[model samples]
Target: MKVLHVITGLGVGGAEQQLRLLLRHLPARCEVVTLTHPGPVADGLRADGVPVVHLGMTGNRDLSALPRLTRLVRAGRYDLVHTHLYRACLYGRLAARLAGVRAVVATEHSLGETQTEGRPLTAGVRALYLAGERLGSTTVAVSPTVAARLRRWGVPASRIEVVPNGIDLARFRFDPVRRHRTRRRLGLPDDAFVVGGIGRLVPGKRFDVLVRALARLPGDCRLLLVGGGPDEHVLRREARRAGVADRVLLTGERPGLPDGSPGPDLPSLACAMDVLASPSPEEAFGLAAVEGLASGLPVLYAACPALEDLPPHTAPAARRVPCGDEEFGRALAEVRAAGPGPRTAPEAARHYCITRSAARLMDVYATALARQSLSPAPQGVSSA
Candidate 1:
């Protein structure tokens, strides 16, 4: 079937990268439209031979985007319209309905107790979300944690589908040669205790805790932050203030999957690291932590429903720590003292392979199409 995916933007964020990965594995013919910021991920998607169109949405309240998107949807004659992220869900749902595509599915990629995709949750957000939700056939949550959050926001449980974000396990597998090459390219010493913190460098991510934790560790302990954001300078200043600036390396946003970007991809960086630490107090699925697990790196996370939802025995190398500097610092030290054990991916990684997620998503798509066939179109929504 022909499918169209609409998203808020195509930046190197978790949701954007997740969409890119999903498009590669989904069986149907798929195209994408990004409202704004067609960045690295967009280029990667194109390289992977997917058609990507930028909708040029100015801001949050751009009403003009709705009609434009509607026209595009109608012209495509898509069998299904899948929307990702918050802004896309709101606009894509309405546009799909206006364009007469009843088989619409929206994925809740980021939903926390206090935020939705890093934006503060307000009364208006809830109202608009619910309003848009009604226009779609189904809402797919990345994890049970996000599904619970959606239910708490008054969305019916029957409408929420749990399809966790997935990873290409082969790409993230540990390789000693790759580890050495990546470390040399990034100027990391062979024996350095590399502590990785992968994600947007935002306040909510609490990466500053890692900087402080670095200060408490030996000089050889390095903090390599994988992604970029507005908080880069803030984290730099924190590193300087904490006297770990020399030890912290921020490789601005890298590709989530290996799409032949210039420098070492995230998988290589993962192999170079000794441990992965996520200090973020709230997370939707904890994708970074799972990627670390795939790379066979010991993971320390403040919040990871992906791991927590699984049986504890599945991920023996992963541990949870509070999002405080001292607490994370102690965890880091404890990991370092133990030395790097065998770098082997745990059973948890296999549970989140991209193929499994793609199969499950196809099921969601088929079910959505079936439901749309049985239900009557909204009053004025003609099958144009």
Candidate 2:
């Protein structure tokens, strides 16, 4: 089936990373469409030979391209219009409906607590987003926690499906040779325990808290921060103020996408780490933590409801630090002293393999299409 995926932008984030893996590993039949102008992610997708259509969206709520989006969907004769993130979800579904696509589906990537850009006009945007989810043929949440959130917000339980985010185990699995090589290449001390964080340098990610936690840890420990954004300068100054400047190695922002590149050294870099920390208070689903586990390193994260689907072993490996730096520091020290335990590489792979997620999504697509075919069209709805 021809599936066109619409997302806000092709930047490095969990949703964008998931999109790349799905296109790379999904059956040859799937295709993609990104609403925002092509960015770094487009380079990765194009490298993998996936077609990405750029909508050239300049501002939020840019309905100017709605007609063009409709034309594109109609021209492609897409079987399904699947969207990720809020803006694309809204615009993708509306365009699909206008183009008479068979099914319009949207994946709720994040809880929508923080904003990268764009301002909502009023309370109506939230209402409209909820309404859009309801009107769409199916709504997919990355985890059961998100699905529950949708139901709590009044989306019919029948309409919401839980399809967890997945990672490419092959790309992220532990590689011993690469581990030593990556550690050496990055110039990290072999004796020092490294705590790595990969995320957009945003307030929600709480890099400042990580810096504070590092302040409390011994001088021997080091923090490696990857990715760059609005929070870079603030976080740099935070490290200086915390008096942990020497202990922190801020890469500012590395190339490729979140979870690092699909490079030879990426897996090693992950596996070489003693611990990977995610201090975000509101994680919908953790791709980095899973990748860390897959790489044979322990993970530490702030307690978040969406993490319920992660395997019990992951939680055991992960020290659930509180939202504050003091608590985080204490927890980090404990985990680092003990060191990462037996590698649960196989277990992690089983839980988050992209191939498994693709098969599951295919099932969702097939089930939704079968139901739509068997049932009569809505009062005003039409088929592809």
Candidate 3:
């Protein structure tokens, strides 16, 4: 079936990247509509041969976006409308209905305990979310933790589907040659213990905690804060304040796509690291930690519902720690003393392979379309 995906923007983030990855794996004929800022991911999607449209939404109050998106949806004649992020969900659902498509689905990719898409859970936000939710047929949560959050927000359990964020395992598979090469290219010392903190440089992500934790670690320990955002300057300032500025590396917004798009890509960076640390106390799914696992790096996370939902035996090296510099600093010291273990992805990493996530999402798609059809479930992406 034909599908159209609507998202707030095509910026480089978990949800944007995940949507691009899913389009690569999902079976349906698909096109994308980004409400604003058709940045790198949109460029990447176009390069990958997906048609994308920029709606040029001015702001949240741009009511004109609704009619424009509706027109695009109608023109596409898509069988289903899949929306991602908050703003897109609000507009995409309304546009899909205006365009006469009933099979609408929105994936909740970043709903923390008290935040949705980095915004505080105000009464107005919750109410608007619920009202827009009614326009969609299904809400896919990236983790059970997020699913629970949605239920608590008054969405019916039956309306929620759990489709975990997935990774491209082959892309993240540890490569000794790449690791050595990447380390040299990035000026990392051979004996230096590299600690990776991968995520947007955001306040809620609490990357500052890692910056401070670096101050307490040995001089040989280096902090590589991957990804970028508004909090980048703040993180750099914190590094300076902590007196570890010389040892901190900030590679701004590398897609790290296994597709060989650019240098210092995520997989190569992953190979160069000895361990991964995520200090963010709020996460719907700790995707970076999983990627770290795929790279065979031990991970220390403040909160990871993705790992918490899984059996502990699946990923023994991944540990949950308190969201404080002192606590995380001790964990890093302990890991460094132990030295690096095997550089091989565990079962937990395999469980979230991109293909598996695609298959599961197809099931959700088929079910949603079936309800609209009032007939046998529609065929979706192949499990193979």
Highest lDDT model number = 1
Total clashing pairs in model 3: 1
Residues 139-240, model 1: lDDT tens digits? 999999889888988899988999999998998999999999999999999999999999988889999999999999998899999999999999999999
Model 3: residues with Cα > 4 Å off, grouped in runs: 255-264, 374-384
- Which of 1 and 3 is the better model by TM-score? 1
Write the number of the candidate with greater lDDT, choosing between 1 and 2: 1
lDDT score, residue 29, model 3? 95
lDDT of 3 at 41: 89
Off-target runs (Cα >4 Å) in candidate 1 are 255-264, 379-384
Superior candidate under TM-score, 2 versus 3 = 3
After the best TM-score superposition of candidate 3, give how far the Cα of residue 115 lies from its true spot, in angstroms: 0.7
**What would you estimate as the lDDT of candidate 3?**
0.90
> What TM-score does candidate 2 get on C-alpha atoms?
0.91
Against the hidden reference, what TM-scores do the models get? 0.97, 0.91, 0.95
Tens digits of per-residue lDDT for model 3, 148-186: 889988999999999998898988999999999999988
Ranking by lDDT: 1, 3, 2
**Poorest stretch of ten by lDDT in candidate 2:** 112-121
Candidate 1 collision pairs: none
